[model samples]
Target: MSADYPSMTTAEIRSKFLNFFEERGLKLYPSSSLVPDDPSLLLANAGMNQFKEYYQGKKTMKEIGAISCQKCVRTNDIDCIGEDGRHLSFFEMLGDFSFGGVSKQQACTWAFELITKEFKLPLDRLYFTVFTEDDETHDVWRSLGVAEDHISRLGEDDNFWAAGPTGPCGPCSEIYFDMGEEVGCGSPDCKPGCDCDRFLEFWNLVFTQYDRQEDGSMPELPHRNLDTGMGLERMAAIMQHKTANYDGDLMQHLIKLGEEISGKTYDADDYSGASRSLRIIADHSRAVDFMISDGILPGNEGREYVLRRLLRRAVFHGRLLGIEGAFLTKFIDEVNAQMGEAYPELLKNVALVKGIVASEEERFSTTLDNGRVYLDEALDALADGAVLSGDVAFKLHDTFGFPIDLTVEIAGAAGHDVDMDGFTACMEDQKARARANAKGDAWGSFNDVWVELSDKVAATEFDGYDNDVIEGAKVVALVCNGESVDSAAAGEDVEVVLDRTPFYAEMGGQQGDAGELSAEGVALTVSDTKNHNGLYAHVAHVAEGTLTVGATVTAALNAERRGFLRRNHTATHLLDAALKQVLGEHVSQAGSLVTPEHLRFDFTHFEALSSEQLKAVEDLVNQQIFASKPVVTRVMGIDEAKAAGAVALFGEKYGDVVRVVSV
Candidate 1:
């Protein structure tokens, strides 16, 4: 960084990226929730996550190109948070994307201009890395006047980009800045590709031009899309001339606040561990704040478990800072006050966020004491350099809510190492057991069959809100488990796909419709319907005759059951409104289930509802029913529905046109 360069905050850095792209005719899109709609993902790990369906041809892009600062959480490196200066559990990715609208030349040229001209960083300190065989990217850099020595061609592990086993993938080019030799590894070969901090990578430009097939072949994608990600915190760090990201303006304030709370100075010789703990607390606080605001709660599985682990880690580190009891709750307002302008959702959910954090802190304090005793005993049993058994560590985690990181930390202090491989095997065994015990066939795997089906099938059209009978509907496809079949005989259990139907697939906590479908010689009893990706799969069994493909069928929903479903669904809406009115705006739906038999609604509340409060909510819902308010369903854009004050479900994904249900 040059002393002559003007200082820029993280907010300003984000604005510059968005403004740069908007000026280039890219639409600005708001950041999506940290919780993703994709079942394969636990959290939105990248800026391109929200656009994956578009890349897979499952959903069409609403705009040709767009730019956004997506809020992302990546826990693969959770253990590296405080140890490394660059890794963060939560960070903002400033990105600009092209959906078959821009060429590589244009994208590369603009990235160069933004780095060199707008930010005014020295051009000589920058180096580029490309895939070993990607001569096109090499040519692009050369044509942009980059020196040959300043570019390095790396292998697939370093330069190739892929989302998963199969999807849109291609070669990527990364931009690294050469910090001074003081941060180098002293091998005399310090360059862009070195592991040392001498070269800090700030941006990655992914040319999504190929689709990686299941057979491990790279084929050309339908469109040459450009996906680029630049870390907002890293950019700020570079501009501020700081090697440690914690010293950057974006995090410095929080670090200072932590110092005030703990009464310990960061970077002081006597308090090195405390300094690291302070940094962890600051970083984890931001992640927890955003997660809770997204309607995630501390729990025992999936996304909730991730949140619980992070929150517990923050609490443990807070203890290391010498601040005892419920200290993390105080940082909620601090994070909101600092980042609320960029994300107003933080401010909107502040009250609920604080309450949840405080409760978790209080709950964990007791567990932390119990866990410490067990950890001490285990450490006492181990000699210097001895490894702790993974099963023991896992038991500490499972029974006492102890995190693996804390175990590793304590064991290291005693000069012992943790058997991470053993720990991983234990965790996997537990997950396998849980899956074996899981109910229903609802748990589906992401394989070639599912991906190909999603690409080949059109979205299922739904008309259950209006029509009870679906006439002239065709059976498009049928599946039995992972196998696709043309027809099914009597007593065969299979998943039937219809071209169009009046059945409401299970979504937004509403149960799937159970009905009957019949044709000239085919009849099937529908037990449940589900929106699998975009394909609505009717899980049914052939009761009377063989159901075959290309057969026109009359899909008749169970009218009495449909009425019960409607009443339950409408009551859910009423209950939602009544809860908000009685429990304050902090009441937001976390999960829901509506069936003819009953309706179950889970919401974000710090404590259990009182008897009187429950009665009030129940009375309010019944009063609406007795008043005989007409159920209104309006078709409009999602934005219009939101502006009209419709309550959006927390985890529900909506499309361009949404059906707004109102009482």
Candidate 2:
């Protein structure tokens, strides 16, 4: 089926690929259809998208031959499109991957050579952008015999594409097909990444040689790779001599159809609904079909929300295009008959996809009335035109998932401007207010010299399940009020003393337990407990007698809190194991919270916990509880725990003896 690709006209270019790679003895393979499950990414956004697990060292590439038609999504610049000449929301990347049993120089040279020779592109028309500090790619390009003048070096921010805070990130060199002088002069400075479109990015070659880690570090990858993504539609536009991507091959069909539906020829110069609707129709039709083919049914959040929003936006444009009766679904067959071979899911799930799109389309058909009213309200807010309030904006986003763009769209129609700056400020203020309230921001920072505190006397560890009471050790330090006085004052004396008390330290997602210390029958209340530098500081207030250093006393802690903390802490470990058991091996703890009520575990599962997976995890956790598993906590070597497979979250460094808890 892959032999007979959809969009065969583009296959003219595909034939050139097969012959060129075959001449070099690199096996050709069909692209994978699997969607990535990384939670951080909404959808597979690049040709190399599905292979991320392999590139990130999460999974090893097992296939020998791989060539794919990868569907990619990029939403970062959604607001800029429809007005720009070359932007398209959804696109397919024609890709060829080499697993690196071949020569590295050959892979680099061949990619450059094939485009210039086999593709019959002009040599001077080609420009190469390399990472500024990347000696590997630089050497490879020069070794390929490209003229030095044709190569451009760029710093990491522009040339290197990092997914995020961590993962498979490395230097990348992109192949740009110059559009000649007619596209206006190069960006003002005529510099790389100057927001100029004169250079039509044709293909990207990511030599994934290093895997970046969660801690902003890099590890050498076992298999150096050659991954490439050519913009298939863009190629068609360039080869066919068209200025706009939508005006080229496949979309041209969809564009003309939208024209018929709208009863108006789209004017390229305007941002009117007529032009937007055509772009929407041409775009949304392709996306909906691809999503359905990938088994993504519409729901809420994540993929479903994307599908729903895309459908509604298309429908909103249909009001612009003047088409009705679930217009999006009607276009599925054209997509199926057109691109179904390379992506068979299109024809396979047409019924299911059509059903879902139709049902949702009909459901939202009634919202036009509501949308009109919402538009009026937004316009009213724009009347004062100073700034939009956060609560009102959030209300729109929450109540109807009404995006700022849609609000802006309506605002444009009414000849008014949105107070975006005001809206954002008000929104941030409200968020700060909420966070401050929750964290007791109500407490104020006193002016300097108000409360002088003293050095803390470290509290004794409860040693978990042990003798609750212990003979008090010598008080190392003592203080009164804010002053580090030698003795407690006559009134209620406040002190932070280190006596060997069995109170537990607040750590490992567990709260510190509280108790009291008494000497010569004079009781002192342990007001609060905290930890600093591996030491538990017991905040104490004298109830009867004066407090002093070298005072020996009886130390006690709250038994109930200790018991609850133990249960919750133990349960967290069990849930961690349960998650690894249910989810794939990639699952790792992100963060967690533990209290007497329950343990909330955050991990790297992509989608929200499915009802079934959620039930399974909950059941597995409670099953551990039912087993009444003895909670064991120990201080062991950090290496010992790591070798023992203990869960470690990001940004936390461990000392020699780390607290390893197991149920």
Candidate 3:
């Protein structure tokens, strides 16, 4: 049946889906940033992330319906990616959303028309699934001329959709395509919801009509919404008559580039060795490119950490393919060239992407070399078929950034096994220690309190950038001894929130400003400042008088201390540029600390720098300091800052508007 239809590129399928819905009056919207605005999500894993507010009734939508091809990143299946034909860390989701405009019948009808008529998929090969209790959706599919036998009623686990534990919840109907009996598990009951590759579920239509209350009661929403998502790559694979999504036009180009760089041909049947490496490289390359273009960088925490893992995994796979030196940038260039048309942001960020990839590759190459020595020693001590201890695996991962899966693969290839259980225990132990240390810190243990206070008080207005003093600032909230309080007496340590402040909260590796908050019959010494979700909390103690919420205070920053801090902060930036100049562009800042007395800059390097190299870097920094280069600061959009070639530090989150500092 697929033979009658012309094979289409992934881009073509995407266009057809958008155009089909657009012609039907659905407004088209571009993909949102992969870095989601929602704090609960690490990355934009779904097409509905941008419209979540609308669905929750927190925000209203101007358009009744919208269609988009959103770029999504999901790493929950990272271990499964490249091992299967369908799993991908990064993919485009073709979605059409309705806010009380489109109905269940319309959604099913449009989806059926697009798949069968526009995409030319055979109707006989299609199947549908609905929640067991959703009679309305079942009847809609039946009325659309789908055979009763083709529609399967699935349980809540498969057909019910929920935003969370409690929120907008409803039943969903999914469309599946059968790939013939030969490719499926031989079972008489194999159907649409079967756990087999033969039934490929390509699209899901969600009918959100109920608002679930905290008490588990689901009341019908006043306005029903429709949200449907279809995987672009999956549809392209079916249309192109390919078994694997990687074989489609979009990913095959990347795989071909991998073959060229590795000097190896990809074998579709070989899933365990070189071919698997090729597939992983192809997948990770695209994910890494998109993540960087979306303003994410390789770092040690949060989404930055996810990007680092993907990037390093791709590099390791390249090593498995016997590719030496830096080859990821080649793949990055191909990604930009092929996908730039659909996502022009990739084209604009090409230089930045390549530079970051090259830097991580260089650092990983050195780490891999060092880790191999330790891994070899551990392997030599183990007898054939013996297990290597998890402590060793943990050390390799912690000290050298080596991945556990890589360790397992290498050990298995050498006729040995790894103590995965022991490795997991070691990881847990480390986390426990980290949690313990966090509890001991004054700032870390009060996070929940700060979150509660943030809800009650408005965000602090920062007035410290230009002036050292902010007069007549009203205290909005106060916390004493980890508990919210109305007032604090003399010699009591407390956290004070002000409506406006001149004290700079600690951020971006810089120390918080030390200041004094004074009012009539009040003298409080603010030792440090910390920001919790834009609410600045001044950690202070009453020196003489009583201080309470609603008291008008004058916040005065120590000018002499701030002068020294500014000098040291500028020096750290100079040191960063000097290190990169002396140690190649591969040198990237790993971490830093900027205080009034001195500054410490941590960076990625292959090994300890020689005395000569250190002297050279020192001289370069000194030269910059002596040259008296004008230190200019400009406020602009993040895109403009990147376009102007401003270096953004990894692990530092930047908002839409950024302050770019240049020397």
Candidate 4:
């Protein structure tokens, strides 16, 4: 460790990184919600997810540049957590971006200055990597005074970063810290590229220059954008002079709690299994605590399934330490206390988080015993070398909450191997079945046509919140069964894209507006509306005449239904306010749906709401309605609204401007 490097807490390290960037004129952006509103993603897996609209040209930049410490979770590395010293299910990413103002030169210069001058780390200990063929980044690193020998030119698989199969992508330059040769794999080629413990990569700087299309060809982006991410835990471990990320203050409190509960010491060389178990428990505690604080509950699919798996794994690992009977819930307080200052939501939802974890632990405890019995029976019936069926393993996973790792561990002890390929196939089949049965059905992925159309036309103008009838709206495009059509005749059900709409699309847990479109000789009934690539597509059934592209129509919302929607929408806000007043400030809306018949709200509460409590909430809402609390609605920027103490939904995506409702 360098003697000049000052020792700092994890929070301090995160603060220093953001402060350094903000001093250079970068606007600070708060971390976005863990749940993603994009249909392609389950969670906000990266800091750039919130800024994707700006990159794709659907929305303009809020600022020329921004800085943030984003909270992210990735389960693809879940299986590698305890086995390695650096993998974490939950971690903070300190990032700085330049939308179009700065170039790669300025980005490289700032990163180097902060690492060397601000943080006071020795320059000799740092190494850089760039794309093999990208002479631009290579030259920039060299211009920053990095030694030629200290920079490595690597291939696309190593230095290129992309969001997905097709989207914004660029070649990246990564900074690595040399931890020394003692931890190396004892090979001559054990450099930064080697997968060894000797070199630790801490930050990645991406120069977003290409817009990769679905056809595998790369075109230059409209503007050369810069995006960078530095792992907070990794940097903390280095500054704190710790060998492993979990050994630092970021996880020490939870690990100590694990030791106290299990009555065991964490010794890597003890071989008594205490060290591995402690690491697993400590890591999982953070993931589970943050997820529940964000209002996620234990369930069977999607983000819910991921949460259930994490909690169950933590409980099972507790069993390994000889700690049993819902002990994982006890660590919730420690998790909140350790990191709640930066994230107040953790403290607010502490009680509900503990409740959810305890309930899940209790449920999985019983399922474990039953799953063991089934596993033993299967092993006894199988021949000596026979493999376990994937269907059987998936049943234990889907029906019971048994992780496949446990099943594999038990089967391996009995001298048998699992058919992993079969298990994977079964898992895929289940996912497909679930998607087919979803409420959105196949319509969820019907946005490709709109993506192409958005390139030609501007986003749809929303006028429903202000006007009930939007006259002279032009029809932009039409689609029937995923295929674009020029015209749709009478009695044909089709999706219609318009230049301006008076219908509210399905968003923020609110139902879409039901309305009608009328022309001289044509009438169409819009059964529902959905937001696709910033365009509102009305799922309309034409009752008469052909609706053609480039034709004008008058869009009007059904007066009766619109009245019901307004009442239910206003009631939802009142109920939200009442829950905070009646229960506690910790209560927040988890999910909601407003239909003409009724309004449903799912909030963060540990236990079932009692009849009296339900009655109290109902009475308060009714009272507000009777008082006619002058339902106030205004259009303002998101920042102004938040500063005025307006409540923001947890998982809803808002634009630069938002609609604020108050009573």
* Per-residue lDDT over 394-439 for candidate 4, one digit per residue giving the tens place of the 0 to 100 score: 8888787888988998899998898899999998897789767655
Per-candidate TM vs. native?
0.84, 0.59, 0.70, 0.81
Candidate 4's C-alpha runs over 4 A off are 1-3, 56-58, 163-168, 211-217, 268-272, 375-395, 404-507, 514-556, 571-587, 604-647, 653-663
**Model 2 stretches astray by more than 4 angstroms:** 1-8, 14-30, 56-65, 142-145, 186-192, 212-219, 267-273, 374-390, 403-406, 409-416, 422-663
lDDT winner, 3 or 4: 3
Q: What is the C-alpha lDDT of each candidate?
A: 0.84, 0.65, 0.86, 0.83
Tens-digit lDDT track for model 2 on 1-663?
011112336557656776676665555644444244333456777766555444533333445435666777665565555665577667878777755554456667878777766666666667788888887777888776666876788888878866556555677888776665566464455634546667777788877677677687788766777677888888776666655677676787777777876687877656555786688777877887777556565656566677777777777778656575667776677777667776665675566567667766777776656765876875675544444455555556546656666666666667766667766776577558745555211111211111112112333444435667777556666655545556663356464556455777666556676788777847788856665434456777777777676777777877877788777777777787888787655455556767766777765443466899879988998888888767677889999998997776532446678877776
Better structure of 1 and 4 per TM-score? 1
Ranking 2 against 4 by TM-score, winner: 4
Residue pairs clashing in model 3 are: none
- How would you encode candidate 1's per-residue C-alpha lDDT over 352-396 as one tens digit per residue? 898899888888998988998998998898777889999889999
- Tens-digit lDDT track of model 3 for 576-613: 89988887765666678999998999875545789999
Q: 56, model 1: CA deviation in Å?
A: 4.3
Task: Give model 4's TM-score versus the native structure.
Answer: 0.81
* Candidate number with the higher lDDT (2 or 3): 3
Q: How do all the candidates rank in terms of TM-score, highest first?
A: 1, 4, 3, 2
| Strongest candidate by lDDT | 3
Worst-scoring 10-residue span by lDDT in model 3: 438-447
Between candidates 1 and 3, the one scoring higher on lDDT is 3
